[model samples]
Target chain A: MTAILLISSALFCAGVYGLLSQRHAVGVLIAIELMINAANLLLVGFGWRTGGAFGQSFALFTMAIAVAEVVVGLALILLMYRSRGDVQVDQATELAQ
Target chain B: MNPLISAALVALGLPAALALLLAVVPKLRRTGKPAALLSILGSLLALSAAGWLAATWLHDPKQVLDLTTSWLPQSGKSMSQVGVHLDGISVSMLLVVAIVASCVQLFSLGYLSDEPAPALGRYYAYQSLFLFSMNLLVLAPDLMQLFLGWELVGATSYLLIGFWFTRPAAGKAALKAFVVTKFADSGLILALITLVAWTGSFSWNATLPAGGAEWLALFLFIAVMGKSAQFPLHIWLPDAMQGPTPVSALLHAATMVAAGVYLIVRADPIFAAAPHVRLFMTDLGAITALFAALIAMVQTDIKKVLAYSTCSQLGYMISGLGAGSLMGGYFHLTTHAFFKALLFLAAGAVIHAVHSNELSDMGGLWRKLKFTTVAFVIGSLSLAGLPGLSGFYSKDLILEAVHESGNPLALGLLMATAGLTAFYMTRTVVKAFFGKPSHAAEHAHGPGPSMTIPLLILLVPAIGLGWLAGPMSKLYGRSYAFHLDTIGMVTIALGLGGIALGWLIYGMGLLQALPRAFAPIARIANGSTVDDLWALSYSKLGMGLARAIAWFDRYIIDGLMNFLGWLFMWSGQRVRTLQTGNVQDYLYAVFGAAALIALWGGWR
Candidate 1:
C-alpha cells in the first residue's frame, strides 16, 4: 500500500506539470484527469494501509464525481470546439482582454 | 385571527397569485390588464388590512409576530434556517409597498390602455412580479430571505425598465440598470457570506462580534450605495427614464429605488452597532442628495428631471436612516413615494397628451390638462419641501435627526440642500407647465379619468401628510424630545421665494431684473453642461457593462467547457483511427489495450 502511494505521488506530480506546461487545451484537460486519478489511487492505497473503509468510500465517491465532471467537461469542450476550431489554449484568445 | 399569516399572505402571496391567474386564464385575455389593475386593487385592500394589523401590533408594543418553519434542520450547525419576524420596520415598508404597487397598477391602466391587449397583460405580469419581490423584501426575516427578495426586486426593475425590448435604447437601459445594481449586489452577497461564516447564522436577531458588525456594515453600505443610486453608481437612474412612463413611475421613481433604504432600515441593529457604517450612510446620503438635485436642475427631459429628483429624494431617505433616525428615514420614504409617484404618473399623463418626454418640446400644458397640471404642482410643492406638504415633514425630520446625529456640518449642508431642492423643483415646474404652448402642447389635452384620478388620490397625502408628524414623532422618536418647530418655515419661505422668482423670470418674464449672483448662476444652472452630463448618463457610458458581462461569459464561464471538447476530439481522433471501418481492427485494438492493462497491473 505504501509503495502504491509513493508511485502515485510521482504520477501526480508529472500530471500536474503536464497540465500547466501544455499549450493545447486537450493535453491540459487530459493531464488534469491524470492528476485526479493519481490522487484517487493514493486514496485507495491509504485506505488499504489504514484499514479504513471510510477512506475507500470517499475514494469511490470521488471517482463518481470525476465521471460526472468528465461528462460535463466533454459537452462544454464540444461547444467550444464548434465555436472555435483550434484546440490550442493560446489560440482561444477570444476571451483575452 | 392569525394576523401574521394574513398580513404576510396579503403582502407576498396576493400579487403572486394574481400574476398566476393572469397567466392561466384564456377567456380573460381581453381583460388581462384590468385583471392586472384589479390584482393591484387586491393588493390595496390587502395592504390596508396589513397596515391595520400592523397598526394594532404597534398599538400593543408587547405583541410580536413570528412565523418560523424548518429550513435545513438535518444539516446540523451548518444548516440554514430563517424566521419571519414582523415589527414596526416591516409594517412601515409593507405599507409603502402596498400603496405604491396599487398606484403603479392604476397608473399603468391608463398608460397601457392604448397598447395592444397582450402587451398590457405582460406589463401587469411584470408589475405583479415587481410587487411580489418588493413585498418579500419588506417581510424578509433573515439575510438569506432578504437577499433573495432584494435580487428579485432588482431583476424586476431591469425587466420593466427595458420592457420595450424592441427598442435598442430601452434594452440598453435595462441591461445598464441591472449590471450597475449587480455590482452592488455582489458586495451585499459577499457581506452576507462573511456574516454567515463568522456568526453561523444569517439573521438580524443574531448579533455579530463588533469587528464583524463593522465589516458587514461596510459591505451593506456599499450595496445600499449602489441600490439607492448614491454617488458614482447613480449613473443608471436618469437613463432608466427610457422605459414607459408608468414603469418609470413604478420602478425608477418610486418603490424600487426605496428598496435600498428599506434594506438598511431593516438591518438597523447591524448598522447601529457599526458607528463607521452609520457615518458612511450619512455622508453618502448628504452628498448624493445635493449632487442629484444639482443634476435635476439641468435636465430638459421632464422625466429625466423627475428621475434625478427621485435619486435626490432617495438620497435624503438614505441619509435619514443613516443619521440614526431610522424612523425619520422611514417617514421620508413613505412621503417620498407618495409625491414621487404622483409626479411621475402626472408626468406620464402629460407625456401621453403631448407625445414627448422632452420638456423643451412641451409648454402651457396647464391650459389643456388642468388636473394633470394641478397634480403636478402639488407634487412639485411636496418635492420642493413646502410647509403644508408631505415633503416638508419628512425633510425636516431628517434635518432634526441630523441635528441629533452630533454632526452639525452635515445637518447644515442638508438644510442648505433643502433650499437648493426648492430652487430646482420650481425650475422644473416653470419650464414644463407654466409657459406659452410649445409645439407639442399646442394640440395637447387632458388624459382620461383613469389617469387623473390616481394623481388626485396621491395629493391626499402630498398636501397634508406632514400634519401627522407631531404624533408620529412621539411614536417613533421617544429618545429625542421632538418638537415641530418653525425652522422649516424659513426653508418654506425661501422655497416660495424661489418659486416666485422662477415664476417671474421664467414664468412671468422677470429674468431681466435678477441680480448677477443669481443670474449667471441660474443661467448656467439651466445650461448645456447639465444636459451633456444627463446625455452621457442616459447613454449609460455606451454599453460598457454588457460588453464586459458577455466577455466574462465567453471566457471565464465557458473556458472549461471548451477545454474538454478539445480533449475529446483529440482522443476520439486517435481512438477512431484504429476503428478504420474494419471489425478486425476494432477487436485487435481492444485486445491490445486489455493485454497492456494486464501487463501494467502485473508489473505494479
Candidate 2:
C-alpha cells in the first residue's frame, strides 16, 4: 500500500510536468485530471493499507472533493471559452509573473 | 484597554470618524471651516495625549504603557501584543503631529472657506485621515500597524493632493506623490520584513539579532529619504502643494512629511546597532540639506519656497540624528514643526487674500493683511534661525551636533546651506509682502477671526519653543548645552544677509541690470532640467527605473494581454470553423484522446 502511494505521488508530479509541457488544451486538462486521480488512487491505497475504515472514509471525502473540483474546473473552461474563445491554458498564461 | 491603549485607539478613531460623519451627513460638511475646526479639536486632544506622554517621560524615559490581549494564538505561538509606547520618540512625534495638524486645521478653516467648490469636505476628510494615520504611525506597537499607518498616509496624500481633481496638474501631483513614495515604501517593507524575520518581533527594544542590523538600518534610512522629502526622493513635495493651501500645511509643512524622520527617531536603538549605516545617514542628511537650500534660491512660488523649506528643515533633523544627538534632533523637529506649520498656514492666508501662489503676483500685501504679516514674519524669522525664535535654539543645536560630528566638510555645507536658507526665505518674504504693490495686492485681505487666532496661538510656540530646548533636554535625561557660538553668529549673518540681498535685488531692482550676466544660469538652475534632475534623484530612485517598470508593465505586460486578445479574435474564428456542424469529427477527436490515454497508461 505504501508502494502504491509512492507510485501515485510520482504519477501526480509527472502529470504536472506533462500539463505544463503540453501545448494543446485537451492534453493539459487530461494531465490535470490525471493528477487529481493519482491523489484519489493513493487515498484508496491508504484505505487498503490502514484497514480501520478511517482511510476509506477519508478516500470517500476525497472523491467528493474531486467531484466539486471537476465541476468548477469545467465551468472555468466554459467561461474561458465564452470570454476568450480559446481553452489553451498555456496561451492564457496571464498569471506567469 | 488600558488608559494609553484607549487614548491611542481614540486618537486613531477621531479623525476617521470625522472623515466619515462629515462625508455622509452632508450638513456637517458645510464649509472647510467647520470640518477644519472639528479636525483641529481632535488633533488638539491627540496632542494633549502627547503632552501626557511627555509628563510620563519626565519620570522614566522608557515608561511604556502597554496593553495587550490574546489575538490569533496558535497552538504554540503566543498572543499578539498591542500597545502604544509613549517613549521619547513617540511622544515627540505625537506632540508634533498634534500641534501641526491643529494649526493647519485652523488655518484651513479660514483659508479654504471661500472656495466655492464642494471638494472642501473631502479635503477636510483627508486631513483627518492624515492625522489618524500619523497618530497610528508613531504609536504603532508592531510592524503591521506601522505599515498600515504608512499606506494610509500615502493614500491620504493621494486624496488630498488631488483635491482639485479637475485640474490636470493636481491629478499629476497626486499620482506622482503616491506612485513615487510607494516605490520607496517597497524597499522599506522589504527591509522591515527582513528585520522582523530575523528578530521575530518589531518592537523597538535593543535585542535584534546579528548580521541583519546593517541591512535593516540601510533600508529604514532609504524609507526616511522617500517619506521625509530627503535627498534623491524629495521632489514630489513641492508639486504636492498644488492642493489647497491648508493641505500644503498639513503635508509639506507639518506632520505627514516628517513621518519618515519620526520613524528614524523611533527606531533609534535599532539603527544604533549599525555604526556604518549611521555614518551613511550623516552624509545623506548633509547632501539633502545643502541641495534643497540651493534649489530653494530660485523658486518663485510662495508655496514652493515653503515646500523647499520643509525639505531643508527635515534635512537638519535627519542630520542631527546622524550626528548622534537624539534630543537635539527632536528639539529641532518640534521647533521646526511649530514655525513651519505657521509659515504654511500664513502662506495659505496670503493665497486666500490674493488668489495666487506666485510671489511675483503678490506684493505689499502685508499692509492689507496685518495679522498675516505678523504671523508670516515670525514664522520666517524662526525658519531663518533668528535668535529668540524657535528655530535658533534648535538649528544651533543641529549645527553644533554637526560640528561635534568630527567632519569639517559636513559642518561647512551645513553653514553654507544656512546662509542659503536665509537668502531664499527672505526672497520669498520680500517678493510676497515687503516690496511695492504688485497688481495682486489690490485683492489682499486679512483672514477672519478663525484664522488669525490660530496663527497667533502658533506664534506663542514659535517664539517660546526655543527656550524649551534646554528643558526638553532635561525632560529626556540626556542634557547637553551646545557650543553654539559659531552657529549663532552664522545664523544672524544668514538672516541679515538674506534680508539685505532681498532688499538689494527686489527692493532696489538691482537684478534688472544683471539679467544679461545672470539670466542664462539662473534660468537653467530653476528650469525643469536641473529641477527635474534633482527631482528625479530626489524622487527616491531614478524615475528612469520606475519608468522602466511602468514601461514593461504598460507595453510588455499589457502588450502580451492585448496580443492574446487579438489572437483569440482570429483563432476563435478558425476554432468555429472546426465545429462546422461536424459531430463526427468531435467524436473522432475524443475517441483518439481516449485511445492515446489508454495506450499511454497500458505502456506505463
Best by lDDT: 1
Worst 10 residues of 1 chain B by lDDT: B579-588
Please count the clashing residue pairs in each candidate, in the order shown: 5, 8
The 10-residue segment with the lowest total lDDT in model 1 chain A: A88-97
Which parts of model 1 have CA positions greater than 4 angstroms off? A1-97, B24-31, B72-74, B77-84, B470-490, B512-604
Residues B286-318 of candidate 2: C-alpha lDDT, one tens digit per residue: 777877777787778888888877888888888
Q: Give the Cα error of residue A4 in candidate 2, in Å.
A: 57
Local error of candidate 2 at B603, Å?
24
lDDT of 2 by residue, A1-97 (tens): 6689789978986776666567556666777778887987887787787678876787788778877877787887788788988876545744322
Kindly report which residue pairs in candidate 2 clash with one another. B232-B537, B232-B538, B232-B539, B232-B540, B233-B538, B233-B539, B233-B540, B234-B538
lDDT of 2: 0.76
**lDDT measured at residue B49 in model 1 versus the true structure, 0 to 100:** 63
Give each prediction's DockQ, rounded to 2 decimals.
0.01, 0.01
lDDT of 2 at B333: 80
Q: What is the lDDT of residue B212 in candidate 1?
A: 77
